[model samples]
Target chain A: MHYWRDGILALPTTSHYLQLVILWSIPINFLTKSYEFMLSAKKIIKCLDDHWPVLETLVGRSTLGSFSFQDVQALIQRHSPGFSSEQVFREAQRLLHHEVLIPLAKSSQLELNRAVLEFIQFLTQEHQLGTVGDIQSRIEDLDRLRGKLKAAADTKDVSEMRRFIRLMDERVREVVKHFRKNESAIMHLVEKAKADDTKLSLAKRYSAVMEAFDEYIEPVLQMIDINAPFQHSMQALEHQLSELILNIEQTGFLQSEKEPLVQLRTRLLDMNQIGREALIRSTDVLMPLREELRKNTLISRNASALLAHLRKKGLEPTLEQLVPKFSSDHQKFSLGSANQITSYMAELVDFQDEAYQMPEQVDPGDNANIRVPDLAEVLKSARVQKANTDLSKWLAKSYPQLPVDELLFLYQELSRAPTLKLQHLEQYSTLEVNGYRLTLHPFVPTATSGT
Target chain B: MQIELEQLTQLAEIHKKLSTGYHVSEQDFALWQELDTNEEAYSALFTALGNQLKRDSRGYFHFDVDDATVNMGKISRLFALTTYALVEFFADQGQDPLRALFEVEISHEILASILQQQYHLFEQLEVFSATDLKREVMNRMLRYGFAKAQGEHFKLLSPVYRYLDALMAVDQLAEFPGESSTSSFTSNQEQADV
Candidate 1:
């Protein structure tokens, strides 16, 4: 446990580094010689700061295992161009001596120390996604340790119980740590996929995203499901731990044991929460990209393929009845449906010619009355009758047989006549003729009929 | 099944638009909202009227007819060809066909270029010039509510997805065997209401 504390004390910075040290400490007991040779945390931190560019390059190429010494020195010189060749060699050697870059057992190739690699990954937030199997195995290990802890508690082997409790704590921390790192890794993957301006097709660019979805998200989703094995195992572990705590409480034989069990319980609960939240965040970031890629692929693939088909088959036969149909106003072209025409004919059958209604012809009783008296004859009569007589009265007497309307028509005509010379009488004389009374200012004929 | 009178406020206008091959999308704000809110009721009502009223998930409504008249069929084929050509046209320009189809306006100048470039294809449809394309297809698209006029240009609406879906389906038909082309296309035709 003090060894674990020493791992925690190695880096006073981010909790992730602390977790990294704890992770490194798990195998520290057997590698004491390497641990003793390892540089102080401050010296390592300073070294990492000085050579961050080189370390970052390595992290970027972390997938490529074990670079040669020359490769490492060249990386150093590339990043620190001002460094002399001797300085680059010396720095590379210093990295090797500090155990920051561990050489392979027999091979000349050197890999970045596992712990340093993880630390750099944490600082850069560029994590490689770990499979769900990694967490599952650890959880299964926790279950196995849980059984061992129960056996130790029954046998009252306090030391074994303490050791199991420590291991369980380590396991829980690792699970939580993995959750955080995997989340950051997923975020990195998403950002990379989206901002990838390469000429790759939509499908190719989102290949990693699709892989992450299939490999990580789907499996983790099931693992963290409320009704799934992961939760059930966690519950069983929790129950076992809680029951042990209760036993310690009642029996009061192992008061020292109570605290570690309690801590383990709290950690287990925290691990579950962190796992769930990490899953949610990963899902949140990935879902939209996944959907966008799916839709884009579907549309573009279809469009391109359909265009090819149109080219090969020609437009008409290719599209044929495949074209989308609209609810067309096709009925407008037809004259009439049989039903409509039949209904119209039925209405016609009951129809009559709507009574021809010859306009009421009033019999023109006499055409002679309608005829106007000859204007010249009237004027001649006026001349013979002599001047100084009321012309209207004479004309009325001469056309006495004419209807009143006709008589008035002759009077108006004589008044306006250009052939006759007449005077306009100012005196009003009421003349009765044709059963109608006429009021008039009689005009007298002039003496001279000016030729 | 019981639709309240209030639920069908736009029923008359909607029916008139749909029956005449007009796709009512969200651009028709009031009517779209009315139908969206009371979709089930409206679907049931239209179904009772011997109409297959479909609401596309992309947010549009239209009536699905089994077969088109000769003239409308010719118009539809021309529309299909134009859309496929557009997809190829945009894709050739390194633009996403779907995004360009919806987001960018197809101006008369753009349409002229499209028509000129796809001359042989358009000739098959009796479309020789831009004006012919506009009169025969683009204007009809506007009239049918497949696109909305934006000044001298136009942008396709969600209903154009029907053609994209048709494009994909036809491609699949060509790619795979044993898939009933008629049933698949007609089902898409069912989806093609809008």
Candidate 2:
């Protein structure tokens, strides 16, 4: 009893105790929350805790996120030195239940949750980018609140007005906070992209750019009417507030309404201006991304087309004419640099030699022994042959009983003969040319010329 | 019915994009908002030029295709085939084609993998290399504003709804009745512009 009494007496006053409680509460609250999260996520955490060495192995591995259960067990055993299969199964089940680890559908693979992986990825990032989605809902919320405020004003409910005012103020503050945070995020993304030059592949690097455009910029732009849905919404709120002020002045009731209405109006104006600037800032950030996309896409498209040319005409012809090359690999050039002309000089002599290789010098002596027939002599011989006998008779004599292919070849040759003025006679004769039935055509007299 | 053509301030820009079949989206907010504000004048001006103003339910404006670009050669068929094949590929991979198209970073490797499955469909396109296919076909789609390229990746844009319609058509063919083919989402999504 004496000791208890002394303990109480030694304790500080009620206020001092309260101060101490307040002083320690922050860290205590944080610790408790962390503990709660750790507890909830314990199944996964316990698995890691039991096999703490596995973390080092995982961190060491470059390729991550997908591994078989057996592979996981191997990693676990290698790290923990005496890990059992039973323990592996138990811990895996626990992690799976907590959703800290996911078993890939239709496979024996497991992966960490996207959030955890992204957190690790964020750590690797020198510059970080953020997306703004929450604020869009905040703006929508403010619009909804304005409706309630208008209704409350009509009813002349003091409590309702106060509640609506407080709620609206909170919403506006949230929106402003969102705007600031998202602006910081954009700055981070841009800096990260700059820092990450060449470290990431082209696709991996521009993935963030695509995400910014598709996920953030496009959607936000869709939300804002600038002059329509938003403008109308602003005008309606302003009109309602002004009329409320007028009513308050008329009835001399709800004196508190004046300040809140003015504050709301000011906030609305700020939001209107902020929305535009937010979009402008987005555009400023995206301008570089956009330029990079355009340049890379342009270079890829042109290279593809040129490669197709290379495939068709072979390398030499394609290489002969110098195409414009983008030195995109060297420096991270802005959009302005895209149009900036750069000069490149290739050795024209080498390309010229390739393009116009001199025709092989055929020694005139190589073909001297081979007598080439004159065009007039060839024509006269064909005239003499045709005058002597028609095509079928000549075919029967010179190339009798030839195969179908040779017969067709002779037919083609006879058709092109200069002096063979042949005409198709319907069922004139059935001749067996090379064991194939032939519909022979009789000669037609041309200007009393006999053939 | 005659009015001064210059009354439509964005006439030249509108005409150029419309001629190329580029959908004028509200996301192109500045010019589109201007167009929206002056809808009456712009419509009239377009009508005077013998082009009908078309408003897509998906927050875009364009000229109705009275003049078929008439360039529907093997290349066009290849483009149409590739679009359909990709939608099928994503659907097979247990992904919603529409969402996947916008979300995924479509690199050369991915393109090659998907194309290998639809080899028969693209036999005539002569898409021997993934790079060539991207440059010749996918890049052309970019030119028509069906998608935008970021590095080697392409994120599809809203105008891809036109392709979505193509995809739906292919599904309707496969399903035949077109009743089971219709999801409640199709009608719901057709509501209005952003």
Candidate 3:
């Protein structure tokens, strides 16, 4: 696993050399021609009676470079029926040491060594997603490459310029590649979080959402933050590259570098956009869950507060204090039902005591001289006074000349007294006051009472 | 408050929906969108209506008014109880209450488990079984447009942040248990009672 991880990362570092070593390792036994490699292989070969054929047959039996040791005995029996179980066990140990069959972290799983597995995956072009390094690294790499490109340009060495362009192209490809790989990895994390294969508690399920945010979202998002150093550096790199393109085109010697330079710059700028896009897409998936988490916590916290309230004041007070009354509309407490009434209760209802006798009534009237006018008389008096203005004639004369509300206000002023007997107008007319609509009416003057 | 008849035509549906406690989210697109695009118009419209339109950062729009109706108080209490009890249950399970509650669907079984873990805290809710409890909680959530029922499970909606705001207040007050939650609940609601 260590070798594979190192080897995968080291692919860019020593590709010219590994291109040859990888070709040799496939046909030949795990030979780095290093002593360690030869020793491990020799160990396996020594354990087997005829190791080459058995190893080759075992490798062939496994498809996709992944074979389960679900039945190690069955595999051995099927491959070499004549071989003893004891012999197979010893040989298997040797094969494991040689990494002919690398052990999976999970038991009952074994796969071809990383070299072979990666090779198969490569040959099949079926790469899965995982973390691609952040744009920060790419930005940092560009800073270094910019110096190199400048040097190659200053030297006027066409071959060196070509070499730098190729290298820059590869670096950008790695960035884009990682962008896609992390895309899948993040998606896988999302799926794992979303999947209900196990009844992991809600808290357990959220572990995946947190993992996506912690491991994938935050770091990448920080790298590409619009004003962050990564973005500024990326913009600087883009500018430098565009300038390089113009210089290349103007220098007129390294015409070959321009196209790739343009491509590099395009990919360079797109790197930030795509990185942002991929993360946003992933975040979009997580947002609902994220929001849910937020809301639920809020609820739980409120519940805690209420519970605290409950503890302090007891249930009745706590409940009475809760907002919006009943949490659910379902808890409607009905008034007592008639069906519950009984004859015994009816006795209580029917039994009534006589009223206490009152003292002799006396009429105390007219001595104080506080003669209160009857409401009807006062209303009639007010109406007669209000009848002084004819609202119908006033509105007909003034409505077209004034805004309706003003006209109504003027009419209201002209007929404040109720004795004027204002009525809704017969025509299609209305007035708005305090957001309420009222039908228009002309004042019909009644007889005056006091005046 | 010079609400043009045209603007009134645009806002009529929004008024009805908001009155019913439904959030006029950006997704609503038609009714409240005018208010969303025009903050001044929203303010004017709501101001004329004697209520304030509050937009939570979470994308749903609701009203914030101090009518403090009886029904609203009851709902707040229910939210208070549910949120607190849920946190307690999640804590018991060694899970982050907030994250898990949102991320995982609270099915009847899970609801049952939560209720079963501690019934007394939820006793005031007057629910008999997990199913009844889930129904009550979800119905309230649905009525308030704070959650949507997905199949047999219910997921909380964003307006639930109102409760979260409450929870934070609770936490703050809890740290100083000397000060009762009731005092802070009102102040907290004033700040973010969406």
Candidate maximizing DockQ: 1
Choose 1 or 2, whichever is better by DockQ: 1
What is the lDDT for A222 in model 2?
67
Clashing pairs in 2: A127-A192
Give candidate 1's error at residue A174 in angstroms.
Answer: 1.4
Model 2 stretches astray by more than 4 angstroms: A1-133, A199-203, A293-451, B1-194
Which residues of candidate 3, in runs, are more than 4 Å off? A1-100, A103-112, A115-135, A293-451, B1-194
**What is the TM-score of model 3 when looking only at chain B?**
0.76
> Which residue pairs come into collision in candidate 1?
none
Put down candidate 3 lDDT per residue, A1-451, tens digits, no spaces: 0011121343333443443344335534543345434435445435444454444344334432345654444566667778787877765665666665666665667765545443433322222333325444665787787788888878887788778777776676656556644554444344334322335566665665665576567777777778877777777778888888888677786787788888778767665666666676667546645544433334443454445445333555645533332122222122222212332475678788989999987875443354433445544544544434445443444333344455455556545644444444455545544344557555545434323
Angstrom error at residue B119, model 1:
54
Q: In candidate 3, what are the lDDT values of residues B1-194, reduced to their tens digit?
A: 46465655566666666655666665456764676666677667775544567777877778764444455665566666666566655643546777766676767777776665335445555765786677677776777677777898887766766666655554333332122211222322221221
What does candidate 3 score on TM? 0.34
State residue A348's C-alpha deviation in candidate 1, in Å: 99
Q: Which window of 10 residues has the lowest lDDT sum in candidate 1 chain B?
A: B176-185
> What is the docking quality class of candidate 3?
incorrect
Chain A TM-score, prediction 1: 0.56
